[model samples]
Target: MEFLFQILVILLAARLLSEVSERVGMPGILGEILAGLLLGLLIVEETETIASVAELGAIFLLFTAGYKEVHIEDLKASSKKAIVATFFQIAAAFIAGFALGRFFGFDFVESLFLAVAFSPTSIGVVVKTLLDMGYLSSKPGSMMLTSAIFDDIIGIFLLSIVVTVGKYNAFPTATQFMLLLGKLVFFVGIMVILGYRVFPYIFNYVQKMHSKESIFAAVVLIALFSAYFAEIMELDAVIGAFIGGVMLSNVAVAKINDIQSKVSGLAYGILVPIFFAHIGMAVELEALNTLGSFTILVVVLALLGKLIGGFVGARAIGFDSYESFIFGSGVMPRAGVELVVISIGREMGIIGEEIFSAVVLMVVVSIIISPIILKFAIQKDKQKNTSVPAS
Candidate 1:
């Protein structure tokens, strides 16, 4: 009964916060996060459950990301440039993050984890912001979108490598990690080829059941089962969720969108808020106010590595300098994805709670800075495009 009551309070609080935030200019997620912070201040223990829900939020979030309309043609069209841009972006971020982690006295595995954390592009913020700003059809927008997708793929691969190779504070024995990688690769390859047959059949069976709840229920099965498969195999559930979503997304594109809508409602309305609030709850918000100079230095350097790597990568592939800045900024919304990564690491005992807290602080700060920078860069470019003196 207490569990039920806590869940109710979390849902109501998250809804209230989201509604209020949306009425103003901010994203509803900002409100949900703040709501979690409020709960942290008032009822701290509830936060652990909330954190669990946040994990659900992450699963649904990534599923929806892969579910949105995408086709082979779309991938084919952008694959060339995306490849060039993403290669350099991952290489640079990984190297820089690893160096910084070691410099901070972390061992090889920890450094690898840090590198993986820095490596991915957050497509959610960039996509939502672009669509909201009515720039979805613009060339830069498409380019950014394509680059972001490739970064996700690269990020997943890097994360799998990090998790398998850098299990604790040392590197995985090459033989063991390589074997794990082989199973993963085999699973992914088989799914990519066979999902076209299996997922469509499964989805069609669900649709014939003739109930809306059935679709959402099917989504739950997919999420939970896929997540479990990874866990039993000694892999992170988020990786399984991502791979599952991507495989089913293309084959069951229509159902994916419908499932995505319902999933989003749940996440935003309840799960996600609980998750982020737990993050804030775990934090003594005041501690952030007093981080040491050296910690601050590490933070700044990490930020610089991302910004420069993103900008240089984008610029290399024909984006103008300012446009490259926008590209990098768009990728900087670091909250949701990083949370998923950190949670898994903690559960596996690969990282302690203290380090987890520090990483969360890093993500929150980055998330705050990313959108503002992205919006500015885009608006500035739009002004430039429109302000030219014509003959």
Candidate 2:
């Protein structure tokens, strides 16, 4: 009964706050996060069940994001811009964050962890904003999604290197690094090949079943299986879930579309909101306040690093100033991957509580700010295009 009550309160608060946020023209996630923050301040204890649900929320969120927003063929075709932008974005952010950490007196490993924390854009936030604005299928949206996917892959790889070096107190040997990379490539390559060739036939057979929920059950199973596979391979489970969704997308678009509402209903109605709120609830407010200036600096660096990296890359690839700004702003938010990196760093003792709190603050602030900036840039670009006569 106690657990039930807590769940009820959380769900109600999240839904109410999300509605308010949407009514104000902001993303509902902002309110959901704030709801979590409020609950954290008020509730004395958080249950393990809640935590477990939040974890599932994150997984389902990523899976839904991949299913809806990303297409592998499209990603491959437009790989050029995404690759260039992601490389520059990660490099710029990592350097800036490392420099900031060093300025604050953190040692080499700690500074590198800080750099990794700032490097990945949270595609969940970016995708939600794009979807809200009806731009998910647009060119800028495609670039943002693809860039974010690369951002996660590279950021996670860098994180593994940082963690290994921190644990051993020495840089990994060249051969060691190559082996890690090789394993990652092999995992992705095999998943892609099998997902493309085998999974479609499996799903095709499943689709012939008369049970209304059979396809949905198959999707959930595949997502969970891929997620487990990735974790066992020492990669992030969210990455596996995303890849699974992408593969399923290629095979069963029409069938999946048929059940999209049912899947989305389950995710958004419960799990995804919990994930966002949990982020807010996890903040250590007192620690954040004590490290206020440092927190502000981190947030500034995080925002500028991604923005400038993305903007410059987009411009280099011939995007107009407005489009470039939109792309840059779209990729500026740091949430899911950043939080995971910081958690790993904390567990490894590479970062202390103060830095953890500050980065959490950075995540919340960035989550709030990035969507607003992206919305403004997108609107401005639309107005500019509207004002121009068709060539």
Clashing pairs in 2: none
lDDT of 2 by residue, 1-391 (tens): 8888888888888999999988876667778878988998998256778877877776777677677666666656757767987887788888899999999898888888889888988866767778888878877788887787667557656766676667655566898777667767877797888687888877788878898888888888887887788778766666677767766677763245667887788789998888777766766788778877888899899899989988988888778999889888988988766766775576567788777778777877888899889999889988898889764
Per-prediction TM-score: 0.85, 0.81
* Total clashing pairs for each candidate: 1, 0
RMSD per model, one decimal: 3.3, 4.2
User: Model 1 off-target regions past 4 Å?
Assistant: 46-51, 69-73, 126-139, 166-169, 209-212, 251-260, 284-291, 378-391
| Cand. 1 Cα-lDDT | 0.68
lDDT of each: 0.68, 0.78
Please write out the lDDT profile of model 1 over residues 1-391, one tens digit for every residue: 7777777776677678877967764556666667666876887465455567767777766655555533446666776876776776667767877787777677777777777776776666557677877876765677678877676667667767777764544676778877888879776776576467777778778878866688778776776677677767666677777777776666553365666777767755566667665555565555555545434644565566667777887888888976887777776666666666666666566755445666666765665677677789888887877886541
The TM-score that candidate 2 achieves is 0.81
- The stretch of ten residues in a row with the least summed lDDT in candidate 2 is 249-258
